[model samples]
Target chain A: MKKRLYIVLFGLAVLIPLGLLSGSPAWGEWDGAYYKKILGFIPKGIQNAKSLNAPLSDYTLGGTNSITGYYLSAFVGIAILFVLFFVLMKIFKARGKSEQSA
Target chain B: MHIPDGYLSPATVVATYAVVAPLWVYGFKKLKASLDEETLPLIGALSAMSFVIMMFNIPIPGGTSGHAVGAALISILFNPWIGFISVSLVLLIQAVVFGDGGISTLAANALSMAFVGSFVGYYSFMMCKKYRAAPFFAGWIALVSSSVLTSIFLGIQPIFWTLDGKPLYFPFGLKVTFVALVGSHMLFFGVVEGIFTALVYSFIKKRQKVVVA
Candidate 1:
């Protein structure tokens, strides 16, 4: 609602779509570069400490990597929507009850 | 479970945050309005319980042994935002400290397990609890539904993202094998999740009655 916040959000909205447009066309040519850096950013050496145990290797089933991470993210979004609605309805019902009691 | 980097597609990563961020913001407001002082502690304790539960991992049928994410149960006790932040933090710890899931896939994992898993399981638990006094059905349904949904989420992981060389052509292909994989685990882990959730819920409910008196 504030001016600066709106400006930042406006910039993100414009940039995200532009990115999607560009990325979609060059999907094949994107050359999996980000994934490597992602793999590197994994704090692996920290594993030696007792605080760390799990390993962060790229998933390789059927002798190759999979591409289904995006779908999972989308599904989570749907679940969040459902929660928002369910809680809102419950609150309205409770408010109605309290008003009636008063 | 935190997904490591490169596991999810860019679309999945960005899209998930887009969806969950709004829901979380909304839930934060709703939770503050609904939960009172006594109820708040129960929610916080349940989250801690969810955190501690993950440490007890069973050896999965496959080579890896994975602990249950406990998102479903958390949602049942508190709300979605609590489940979201709690599990996201769990996934973060798994990624940053433990290196269980890739950094890229971490967001996706949080969304799927916490966002998806929590709501699906919580709603199922509520429905069952409404129709039946027995916590068994509530727990069972919560566990089963979350398992199935999460498996579907996992199955689609290959469809959205691209990681070179490792092309996943699952013979099961999110249909048959995935159902079997997700379903079989629900037999045990689902029940475990449900039982754990129900037990905690019952305990808290009793504790609340005592404190209110």
Candidate 2:
């Protein structure tokens, strides 16, 4: 089961760049300017809403090559998830020990 | 559907966070109980699978694209709570690091995509376990359920909140949101999710007896 799952993840990782082939955005997940162009005005909240500067905004890195960026983003995302789970595991273990002692 | 930060009203944000806070706390407890040496690697790999699968973003007709969330596979294989927590963590990473979603809308996105998707997929698989296509239907229903909730959140924005004849927040009403978001999912992405879930579930189960390193 583990080996099969790993194979699937690796296969998907290798194919991750295919995700960038379609340049179109998901429905209803568009830019504020899309609202302005279609509805004649951007919604107030959407227009005024403050956005944080994400390190990898829209999954694109510093360079213009999107395929490479998407690949990096996939690896990075996966690594972060694993790291978080490991951290959570450590925290849980520590708390369990404390509770047992109590 | 990853809602951006300002798409929802403040009231909606607060309300969603309030609803998700307790669920997350309880879900974390559930996850802690389930996670052990034997299951940790499997669960982590499944969560990573969910993240990687979402990157596919299959293009559909009508100039929109979406991806099949691998939530159903996890939900059926393990349990709904773990699926929920796993995907919620994925969404959090997307929002904070990739900017795929927004921080403010995290609660709402988690609710629809993680919580609702997991529960719907889990129950659907259980009910249809007699059939080989249970995972397919589970994935289809899970994505559809997530779409329904996301549409509701996006659709209700303009109805309640507005400013001086101009709509505020998400401008689309229930009708448009339901048609565009839900309609697209049911027709295109849902099938992709269904097929992926069914194929992957069977693949994993098939190799269980092999025990290859």
Fnat of each prediction? 0.06, 0.82
Error of 1 at B57 (Å): 0.6
TM-score of 2: 0.97
DockQ of 2: 0.85
lDDT of 1 by residue, B148-212 (tens): 64456455754543335332311113675355545655666666666656665565455667877
Clashes (N, CA, C under 3 Å) per candidate: 19, 0
lDDT of candidate model 1 versus the reference = 0.49
Residue-level lDDT of model 1, residues A9-55, one tens digit each, is 23422332222121121101112343335343322212212323333
Model 1 has a DockQ score of 0.05
How would you class the docking of model 1? incorrect
CAPRI class of candidate 2: high
